[model samples]
Target: MTHKILIADDEPNIVISLEYLLQREGYAVLVARDGQEALDTIAREQPALVLLDVMMPHKTGFEVCQAVRADEAL
Candidate 1:
């Protein structure tokens, strides 16, 4: 199966580049422009991996990681 990867960053260029590279590598990519969106996408898509930005808007990457870890269902 093709694994789904989440790219959680506010920068458009980085998102585009990463999406291109990952897609070329045969992984299904999902993008989230901010931390809150990242968290929501994570819950909905259940990506196998997340490439997260540390200083995103709404919530930091640390906060997102903590939230994921805290949630038993995730």
Candidate 2:
């Protein structure tokens, strides 16, 4: 089975590098520009893993993680 990975960051450079690297490694990659986008993507895409940034627009990684942890459906 293919693993879908989500990269949540505000930095364009970091997102680019990580996306390229993960794609080369044969993982399906999805990107979110900020923490709010990350949460939206997570709910929609259901990625297998998430690489979240500690600092981002709309929300922080800690907040996003906490939201996920509190969700019963996830």
Best by TM-score: 1
In TM-score terms, candidate 2 sits at: 0.96
Pull out the clashing pairs in model 1. Answer: none
Error of 2 at 40 (Å): 0.6
Q: Per-residue lDDT of 1-74 in model 2, one digit per residue for the tens?
A: 88999999999999999999999999999999988999999999999999999999999999999999999775
**Which residue pairs in candidate 2 collide?**
none
| Residue ranges of candidate 1 with Cα displaced over 4 Å | none
lDDT per model vs. reference: 0.96, 0.95
What's the CA error at residue 38 for candidate 2, in Å? 0.5
Give the residue spans of candidate 2 off by over 4 A: none
Predict model 2's lDDT versus the native: 0.95
